[model samples]
Target: MQTIQALNQGAEAVDGEGEARVGDGTKVWLHWRATAVRNSEGKIDYFIAMFEDTAARHDVEVAAEANLELMQRLSALKTEFLQSVSHEFKTALIGIQGFSEFMRDADQLDLNDARAFASDIHRDAERLDRMVTEMIALDHIESTRANLRLSAVDINAVIEHEVAVTKISAASAIVTNLELKLPKVSGDEDKLSEVVRTLLADAVKYSPDGGRITVSTSVADGTVTVSVKDQGVAARADFDNRLFGRDELYASNPIRKVVGTGLGLGIVRQVIEMHGGRLWVDRVDGEGSEFHFTLQAVDASLVTPGGGRVA
Candidate 1:
């Protein structure tokens, strides 16, 4: 009423309290202005009013705000990942540098002592090399657009070969409980081998000097499951709580001081998922933890239309 009276008094006024009809006949918050025109006798003429709808613009602003918040979160995650990687790299370099210095200044040492220094230097160099290689592999696994090759693989053979070839055992015993008649599964052998190697390496590193590590396999319900159990500091609950959540970025925890790049399990998880499998942790009362993963077994139903079994 005040706006109408202002127009009647030969003045312009704005009415921004009401809503306007949209293209879909829905009402939205609106802004309007009225300008009164005068005739030659100075009497008020008809009024011209304009309205602007603000809902669409408001929606756009909201979406942009949400996207900005998401970007900020991603930036923070990138910073954290970089910091973790840098720390791991520096730790590896320290080992190499310290051992190299020891090997360089062993002039007065006995032959066995000099050989030991050389061995330590070589071990440190190997450690650094492993970290770099694993880092590259993690980057590839995370970003690669290529699809995994589906081939019939002997899981038992892959496990045996990986266990036999790995020399990282600091444990007193490694017990293998492999199923002799394990069925073939569709997977990439190399990636699966890496998974086995990563699990075994972790077990060896975490287990006490005389603790036992056990590798086992079983098949049921068209799935083959493999587990690596380590008798070390038990963190199964901690691991399970974060396995599918935010714990992926945590490089180390208070449970152990073992040296690692912290990307091995991440890569293992990626590879297992790529093969249409799942990985998990199982807590043992006094036997530490067991890491398990499952792969679909090759069944006769996977036979193609051409009567060829899926390989």
Candidate 2:
């Protein structure tokens, strides 16, 4: 029998009978009773005996903790709403002030410095736009807004449309490698395009100077890999665990220093997941990062293929 000392969630509490050891992901409640005992030298010490088999109590606590988590998420959502609203108001005010000042002192202001200030205002406004859009997107996903509008749209054409809309003139060079395919995806065309477009836009924002990003789509292992690969730092070795997160932006963009509110991926993830697909970030070792979202290639065996339900 293992000597009595202490036990916690991370460590195993060996059963005195050698039957089992507490393992990871085990739902357990731990309680200890302290009793005074005399040592051989007549000194007093506390002997703690742990009690187990409190499943009902543990379930009650788990439910309470889950409710607390829900409250916390709701609180966080409220905070995000307040901050986003304030940011939008501030951005509008700054734009008005900046453009008004630029117009009033057009002759005296140095053009370069004025342009930099203008850029800051522009970036903030864009940031606010992305934030608002993501909030709406998350809501829509949660609601599972019904739109099964399916069409025979060319998947390749949609990629091109997104690329033309989000052209980046940064030091990084955007190279697209989207190959053609057959039996177009039997799903909503507009929503799928948004997923690819947003992912590419993000990759461009985090790439290095003269960095290259390639967009590719192909069928492999009965799954389609719609990927946006950037020749910049992919996932930070330190923070790869939280890839589908925005608050981890500083970790992702360490050197080139791209500015982001860290909410885009959360939205992107929601959209991708709503479509009954897998979304993930893969690091390219010596290269950059590639975001590969997977979807069922086609429904050839099902013939009709109209029962597309979101899981």
Candidate 3:
């Protein structure tokens, strides 16, 4: 139709580009050009049209655009990761340095005051260690170099131990609602323990004013789910997907109030995945957050009246 119109209007040439499906049902980019061939009387005549397949060039252009976008995303992630690491390190270092300096130069430090300062320093040091450990653990898992001592792990025992340890340091009250006679899971005890610990610590850290943290475990369809619910500042709806992502250390909302390297949750996700499980978080009644993860439940009958799995 355009070719006929161009010819009737005496236009010298008409050109356009569009996408078309080929005989193989594959879409391809095409460019067409139509030229008017006039008669000796300088009147209307037939038009000649030529079509060129531009799929190859189009593919190259699209690939280049995708690569550019990927590079930009990677650059942004690097910047954010560095900023998060620097902030966490600086905060811990400041606490350690201030407490050490105060203890060193104090004219008459009482026994209780000295002990408190030392405890503060130790806590800061431990935080620094934990941050470093999480980074390394994530790296190892990503590299597939992590050696997991997989076994029939008692999930309740891991949760109970982590909750108890967290209660000692957490200002919030930690409660557990573990199911009895729960089936064991095939996972590394140490790694599972770290997962629980990370979740509990996050709960305590976010619940700055000391709220109740409930840790619960349940089983369904050969999967055991553990949830850590915290009555703290709820995460934004948009930030839910990025919560376990290593690239996003903190959200640009109320969740950023708590200081963290953001490596803990990422590591938890990796560990859970390595154990053939999944992890996720949800808003608790629009006022708090509940982090949950699932592990493959082992059959109860596979055990020989003991905690170990039978071959």
Candidate 4:
């Protein structure tokens, strides 16, 4: 049975009934309640507190812990599968690259035909490599094995590098605004790279030929900011919560159009959190989506001449 009151004064909330919820953060104390009592004079006398029914809270906590354990196990299994897939694909890619190179050297097809075929092969190989790299990166971030060696990297430089690696040309006019003085943010380079890489990828994916993706960075007050804004249609008004969190083979909703494993954004969240940062997906006019993340910029003393902070 739960105790209704305590006979002693100076009773702590710990010696009470009912939970005391701490503020905006997360922390709960159970079996705690606080009350006050007065004497015959109606003046303040003492307080009464009781502690009871901790078993229910304990059961809930245990269930939550069990669920966490299950999720970790599932994540580990998925990591292994991704690694295996990457390895197999790598071997296949080598064979295909060899054949393509040989065919290019032989000059069997007309100039136009050869060029087109070679370009296709190159694109496919690059895509495969990107996929493998992303998978391994997600594995590292999820496992907390990512190094936090924060650097003051140039936002523009990073964008240029990733674009070069992906061979994505600035075909659209909107792809032009990647230059901005972002606060010399200090965070793990690998993790930050994953964030921007995913955002740019999604932007490129949803963007049509005429579409423009505005990648902007700005520093304000003391907070550093980075944003990937796409001209693609924002998410539907009816979209519930599947913006970047679906692991199933198909889209979870009827209005879903894109093909994805929903793993990218979730991994983004993990990476940001690991760096003590925050990430969010905002639906612009409920017609398109933009992804953003923020990290605390390191001090000037931590920065080098190139803007990347020293490890």
Instruction: Indicate which candidate wins on lDDT.
Output: 3
Cα lDDT tens digits, model 1, 212-306, are: 77788888989999998888765645667342322332235344444545556766776786676888987776677788999999854332122
lDDT ranking from best candidate downward: 3, 1, 2, 4
TM-score to true structure, per model? 0.56, 0.55, 0.56, 0.50
Q: How far in Å is the alpha carbon of 272 misplaced in model 1?
A: 0.2
The digit string of per-residue lDDT tens for model 4 on 85-151 reads: 5655665577578758777588466778677767767666765665666577666654553346777
Tell me how many residue pairs clash in candidate 4. Answer: 15
Error of 2 at 249 (Å): 2.8
Q: Note the Cα lDDT for every prediction shown.
A: 0.68, 0.60, 0.74, 0.58
- Tens digit of lDDT per residue, candidate 3, span 1-311? 86678667777888988899989999889998988888898876667889999888887787667555544544454455567778878989999999999988999999999999998898889878877875666556555523579888888877777776777777888877776768888899987898898888888777646578888888888888999888876765675666354223234435334345676676677678667688888875546889899999877832222222111
lDDT of 3 at 221: 88
lDDT of 3 at 185: 88
Q: Candidate 3 clashing pairs?
A: none
Instruction: Give the better candidate number (3 or 4) by lDDT.
Output: 3
Cα displacement (angstroms), candidate 4, residue 58, comes to 23
Off by over 4 Å in 3: 1-80, 86-131, 143-146, 243-257, 301-311
Ranking 2 against 4 by TM-score, winner: 2
